[model samples]
Target: MITKWEVLSLIWASGVAYTAPRILNRWSLITTCDPIELCQGCRDERRYVMQEGMTYEVMGAAGGPLQVLVEAFAWYLKPFLPALRRAAGRPPLPTCSKGSCLAHTSTRRRA
Candidate 1:
């Protein structure tokens, strides 16, 4: 016989099991960037991180994992996104430049 407590515990565990990895996968986007100063690379990473959250929130367990996987895979090809867009007949986004701006410094860094 299944007691009420056991049923509740199963539900709670299931929720945690589903959410825990999604949360960690989303957090993987955090890279080198000071809390106050976000480099262009930081901005892109953060944007993708937020997209992960939104994707999971909207898609739920059904589609979220696959969509997030696609997104994560896309991050590996960041250098090619500009060319991909250009080939698609879209104007390049301004942040596609080779060097990332760190804070307000004259030195532009990162790929």
Candidate 2:
């Protein structure tokens, strides 16, 4: 029952209905290509101020006198601890190859 002009009009209307929203919703449709230039002055300065304050607090706590002294003492004693342990006749540290690997491999083979 449709005539030629009516069919062409219907096709044009359907095409517009399908593509209009997609064109409108595109990222470039609503936003500027030079976004950084537009937004450069809109950033919140409070966040930067708070971050600097927290950095100063953390640095003060980590480098306090007692912390510095403890770190220095540990560094000084690092080389002597192994020799002292041997002289005390404590058993040498356990080897992972002897204990962990043997147990896991034995269980896997049995299974």
Candidate 3:
């Protein structure tokens, strides 16, 4: 039979186990920088850093870039994205890699 102390310890251990991964993931998000020259994917990852950086630089009496307010808005639109991406004639936005923005040639959508 588990004693009260054992149950408490188990709860403590469980909480630690659960939070460790999440904390580490957040830490990675906070520190990593965009190595890909043309990739702006850093914008989202850097959001984690923005909050941790000097508050004055982010939003202070002097004023600066606003804390991201689009996270929830983007989440809400996720379900409708497929339908919204469709257009009769407009081409897809160019995709890029480390140094290349693949825009000069027509990109074909995969079947």
Candidate 4:
């Protein structure tokens, strides 16, 4: 009942189905890779570290006014880092539509 020809045909069909869209899609190359790391928590931690470093440079006055402004913005983003860590199951840098970041404020207080 199970012939090599049938098995080969099935495998070839599945392969085509799986890869067809990738090959046929006009904008296949337009899709961009995510900058954030694999885990959401790890990505958040990275963001926090970068922000903290920027803030330190700004406070130390090592950079100009524009740099200071950018640093200040980085600092302002700190409070949302924990939430980003929690929402890691989703995209590495998920959009803040679910207010997951607000939930994290309380979680951070406990830790």
Estimate, for each residue in 1-59, the C-alpha lDDT of model 3 and write its tens digit: 99999997777666655555544453344345343321443443455455644564645
Number of residue pairs clashing in candidate 2, backbone atoms closer than 3 angstroms, sequence gap of 3 or more or interchain:
0
lDDT of each: 0.55, 0.42, 0.43, 0.44
Q: Output the worst ten-in-a-row residue range by lDDT, candidate 3.
A: 102-111
RMSD of each predicted structure:
12.4, 31.9, 12.6, 19.2
Better of 3 and 4 by TM-score: 3
- Please report, as a residue range, the 10-residue window in candidate 1 with the lowest summed lDDT: 102-111
**lDDT (10s digit) by residue, model 1, range 45-72:** 5677666667667666756566545544
Which candidate, 2 or 3, would have the higher lDDT against the true structure?
3
Report how far residue 98 has shifted in candidate 3, in Å.
Answer: 26
Rate residue 81 of model 1 by lDDT.
Answer: 86
Please rank every candidate by TM-score, starting with the best: 1, 3, 2, 4
User: Compared with the true structure, what per-residue lDDT tens digits does model 2 show for residues 1-111?
Assistant: 999999977776665555544433322221322333222221122233234445556667653433324333344345686777799997544322323333323435546
How many Å off is the CA of 17 in candidate 3?
0.4
The candidate scoring highest on TM-score is: 1
The per-residue C-alpha lDDT of model 4 at residue 2 equals 92
Q: What number of backbone clashes does candidate 3 have, counting pairs of residues 3 or more apart or in separate chains?
A: 0
Residue pairs clashing, model 4: none
Error of 2 at 39 (Å): 16
Alpha carbon deviation, residue 27, candidate 1 (Å): 4.8
